[model samples]
Target: MGGLKVLCIAIVLINGQTIGTVAADGPFPDEARRMRSANEFLSPALRAEQADPIRNRGMLWVEQGERLFAQPPPPGGAQSCASCHASPETSMRGVAARLPAVDAESGQLVNLEGRINDCRILRQSLPPLDYETDELLALTAYLTALSIGEPLTVSIDGPASAFYAYGQQLWSERQGQLNVACTQCHDQSVGRKLRGDTISSAVPTGYPAYRLEWQTLGSLHRRLRSCQLGVRAQLFELGSREYLALELYLKSRARRHLIDAPALRR
Candidate 1:
C-alpha cells in the first residue's frame, strides 16, 4: 500500500487544535474563533459553487486528470497510474484527506504534488514534472476530487510532529516588509475584506483550487506564494520544505474540514 493509503484508513485524528473541542489557541485570541471554518465566510454566489462541484469550472481539470491517470506514460515508461491502481474511485477515495504524509524512505514529509513527482521519477522512470503545471494539477485534482466531502485527518503526531511544529512557527511568525504573519490576516481578520476578498482561515481544505485571478486550478503552494508576495516576502520554491511545512500546518488547522479541492475562489 502507498504511504498515504495507510494513513488515510488507519489514523483518523484531527491534526491540529480545534475550537471549543479543546482549549482554543491563546495566541490567536477571540478573533481567531470567528475563522473556525472556511465555510463560514463566503458570498452567496461563491458559496453556491462550493456546494456544487459538478457545476464548478474546476471540474474541467478533474476530467482532464481522469484521462491523464489512465493514459499510458510517455515513451519507455512502465505503465500509467491507472494500470497499477485500477479505478481511482476505489483506490483513491479519501487519499487526499491524508496527504502531505511522511515519506518512509527519506523521512522527509512530502505533499501530494511532491509525492506525485517522486512517483513519476522513480516509479514511472520519468523526470519530475514542473511545479504548478497543468498536468500536475490535473492529476492532483483527480485524486483529491475522490476525497471530496471527507474530513482532513492528517496525522501530526510522532514523526510528523517536528514538521508540524516548524509549520506552526512559520504560520505564527511575521514575514516581509509589511511585517504580517499568516495569523494576522487569517487569524486576526477572518471576516474582514482584504482588498475585496473576505479573509479565510488559511485552512488548506480547498486546494488544487480554481482562483478567478489564475483562471485555472492551482496547487496550494501557488496560493501560499501569493500570500508571500502580498506581504512582500521572498517566495519559496514550489515544492520546498518551507511550503510543505506551511501546508502541514494549514491542513492541521483545518482538521475536521472536508476536502474541497478544485474549489472556486474569487
Candidate 2:
C-alpha cells in the first residue's frame, strides 16, 4: 500500500475542514442521492468476490484491447501496445490502481489513458487518439483488468508533493463566474440535478466510459476538463501539469470506488 503522506499533509493545510459525503443538489438531486446513498466503494475483497459475468465482460474488453494494440493503423510505422505492454497480466500489473499518477519529468498527475497517449506520442510517434476513442477504451479496459483486485494507489512524493498540494487547493477553492466549487456540486450536492441530468458523486474509478449522450466512450480527464469548461473555470490543456495534479487529487478521493467502464451515463 502506498502511503499518501504528502497528500495528507497538503490536504490538511489546504482544506482545514472536515471531509463529508458529497452533497445533494440539482434537478434530480433525489435520484443522485438514491444512487450514492448507500454506495459501498469497491474493496479488494468485493473485487475478488465479484460474479463471473461482470469479470467476464471486463475480460472481454481486455482481450479486445489487446487485439487493438496489435492492429497497426495504415503504413505500419511502429507496432501496437503489445510491442511494449507485452503480457497484459504482467506488463500492466498494478498499473490501473496507480493511475492518475504524477509524472516526474513534467511534474503532472496523469490518468491511465493520458499515460497511454503519452506513450503513443513519444514511444510510438503516433498521433494520440481522442479521449474515450475505441483505442483508448480497449487499452483502459485491458489495463484496469490487470488490477481487478488490487487496491487503488496514487503517489504524492518527491516532485509530486507540490503538485498534489496544488491539486488539493484547487479542489477546495471556490471559483468560477457561478462562484461554485467542484465540491459544491460533486461533494456537497452529490445527488442533485445540474440541468435535466442527475448529479453523480463524481467518482473516478472508471475511465474511457461509454456515455450515451456522447454516443462514445471517453477518458476521465476529458470529463474533468468538460466540467471545468462547464463552470467557465480555467481549462488546462490535455495532459497539462495543473490538470494532472487535479486528476491525482480527484483519484485520491475515490480511493475504493468500483471501476465501471462501458458504463451508460446521460
Candidate 3:
C-alpha cells in the first residue's frame, strides 16, 4: 500500500513539472514568432532616415567638429587628428561603418570614438576627452558623417566573446533592491511606462544622441553606465574594457536597426 502511494505522488509531481515548463516557455516562443513575422514590414527607406545623415543645411556641428579636429590638444601634444588621418575622403574613408569591433590584442570591444581617443592618448600622449563634451560630440558627428551611407559593422569574436557573454549575462541578471534585469524592462515589458515615459524598444543604433532628459548629447557608454547606476550596480569606468565589450554586443544586436547617429531623442 505504501509503495503504491509513493508511486502516485511521484506521478503527480512529474505531471506538475511538465505543466510548469510548458507554461513558462510556450508564450514566449509564440510571441517571438509573431515578432519575426512583423519584422518583414520594415522599410529600407525608413531605415535610411534613421541613419541620420548630416545634411549641409543643418549640419553646423559637423563643420565645428572638423575644425576642432584640426586644432591641437591642450598643453602639449602631437599633431591634431588631421595630421595622419588627413582628409575624410582618404583616412576617414570606410571608417563610420566599421566601428564597435572586437580587438583581439586588447580583448575588448572598441567603438570609433574609443579608437580615436586611444590614438590621442597613446600616440599623442594626451589625456582622453570626456564623454559627450563639445569636442567629443563634434568629433563624432564629423566622423559618422564621413561614412554616411556605409553600413555599420560590428564583430563578436575572440576575446570579445567572453566580454559579450558577460554583458548578455548582465542584461538578463536581475539587479537593484527592486530586483530587475534590463530584459525585464526592455525586452519582456516594452511599451510600458516607467516614471511617465513610454518605454519603446531599447535600441542602440541611434547612439551619441541628444537626450531631452539630460538636455545634452551623450554617448552610448554613458547611457549604459547611467543605467548601471540606476540599479545601484557597480559602474564601469569610462572607455573600460567592459564598456567596449558591452558596446560591441549592443551594437551587433542593433545591426540593421538604423544608424541614428547624433539623434535627437526625448
TM-scores, one per candidate:
0.85, 0.67, 0.70
lDDT of 2: 0.59
User: How many residue pairs clash in model 1?
Assistant: 0
Each prediction's whole-model lDDT (CA): 0.76, 0.59, 0.59
What is the C-alpha lDDT profile of model 1 across 128-174, one tens digit per residue? 78878889998898888777767777888889999999999999999
The order of the candidates by lDDT, greatest first, is: 1, 2, 3
Model 3 CA lDDT for position 108: 53
Q: Candidate 2 has what TM-score?
A: 0.67
Worst 10 residues of 1 by lDDT: 11-20
Number of the predicted model whose lDDT against the real structure is largest? 1
Instruction: Indicate the residue-level lDDT of 209 in model 1.
Output: 84
Clash counts for the predictions, in order:
0, 13, 0
Per-residue lDDT of 86-108 in model 3, one digit per residue for the tens? 76555785575667776557755
